[model samples]
Target: MSQRLVVGITGATGAAYGLRLLRRGRELGLETHLIVTPAGVLNVHHELGLDRKALEAETSFSHAPGDVGACVASGSFATAAMVVAPCSMKSLAAIAHGFGDNLLTRAADVTLKERRRLILMVRETPFNLAHLRNMTAATEMGAIVFPPLPAFYHRPQTIDELIAESIERVLELAGVAGAAPKAWTGL
Candidate 1:
């Protein structure tokens, strides 16, 4: 059986990546636990063109953002790993320092403390040294810190293509196969 993976949506801009990851994980026959923060709600509308409430109602499965009792919050739940797509600097800092105030941050902390794969798609640009330090701390603690940088070799012509490449890379790094886009061979 495929394993379960937790996908966290934060206040960062690329909310589409979280939605796409959930849909893809389900398609791959893997159960997914989705956590969308309160700020994640507003950011989704601003960035993804999808209404959070409506989509959550229509999707395969989900939990309220702030639900701390969700299964994904525990390490004993026994899943593959967790991915915080478009991970806000706030969330990253929280995870890096082992803060578990919210479900998203809590799950990330669980992933790290348990030494499981914790892929953080960190989203920030022109980051200050402090942001870099946070990312470094998370990495030192075994978090896969990935910034949302586009892959040009894919020659993505649309925003969706670019987003897909980034999410695929995150999934691949977490040891989930077949989620990545076809290799970029120059035409």
Candidate 2:
């Protein structure tokens, strides 16, 4: 079976990151198991103008955020990694605190316990101490807290290019081999 990656899209602002990740994962032939929180569904439509069904159609598999019994929720199910693109503070706190009230958080909790790669693309700014502490806590638990900061050296000509770069880096970190737009060659 192809490598499986669990993608959790939260209510954070940068919905495009999650969308691009799914598209690229499919292109790279990795099986993507997607779970979008209720807020994530709303934000995808609000930010990307894509409805939940359209978002679901982009991935190899889809699970409701409430589906605690999903395969990905179990550590025995082999998966390469998990990424929470545009991870919201609410979700971050839940994961940091080991609160698995729903499938998304439950899967994250499992990812951590299973010693699997867990990446959180936390999309928030003006960090208060609480956010910092949560990030530190998550990091201590082995979750990569990646904030989608733009790389200016690439001189991206469009927003899509920037989003693509973030997706590429996330994939690389997850050990997924795939094509991404060219990286900076260095001056």
Candidate 3:
């Protein structure tokens, strides 16, 4: 199968999810097309102590957020799905409204228009009505709004374990096999 997943990292707190997703995608032999917002770069450095170069090395292709003409921005690019790990509220709003201001949002819009899988790993807490409405709108338009809530039933002991579970679920939504440390086997 041609495994090509488009990854978008926004200015959310859970930068680790996006980073791990890229690494895991590579390990699974999937071609990762990464696009990180400017604030995503800051969050990666602040939370993961990583830079853009580090991120570029983790994926098959990295596109500038402002590059509107990037391959992944078009539906003809033939990607399996598009995921916005650590999807910020701003990006969510843009996608919800069909706004294609930048490469990330444009790719997400295209993904939705193409009727392909679009997963948003929303990282916001204490959602207001507007946030909930935007999420509802995105879902109405065929986007999966996934919050990175930890599942304690998995018996996660470390931060990495929690993040891994989240990434695994996100990948599952996109129909990709992920490095899930503790996939549930029983109730």
- Higher-scoring candidate on TM-score, 1 or 3: 3
In model 1, the runs with Cα more than 4 Å from the true position are: 57-60, 184-187
Model 1, position 174: C-alpha lDDT score = 76
Q: For residues 49-164, what per-residue lDDT tens digits would candidate 1 score against the true structure? A: 77777657534557786788988788888878898887999998899898898888888888888889998888888899989999999999999888878888767899888888
Alpha-carbon lDDT of model 3: 0.93
lDDT (tens digit, per residue) of candidate 2 on 1-187: 8989999999999999999999999989999999999999999999999999999999999999888999988999999999999899999999999999999999999999999999999988988899999999999999999999988787889999899988898898898866465667767
Mark the regions of model 2 whose C-alpha exceeds 4 Å error after superposition. Answer: 179-184
TM-score of 2: 0.97
Sorted on TM-score, highest at the top, how do the candidates line up?
2, 3, 1
Taking all chains together, the TM-score of candidate 3 against the true structure is 0.96
Q: Would you list the clashing residue pairs of candidate 1?
A: none
Name the best candidate (by TM-score).
2
TM-score of 1: 0.91
Worst window of 10 by summed lDDT in candidate 3: 176-185
Best-fitting candidate, measured by lDDT? 2
**Model 3 clashing residue pairs (backbone):** none
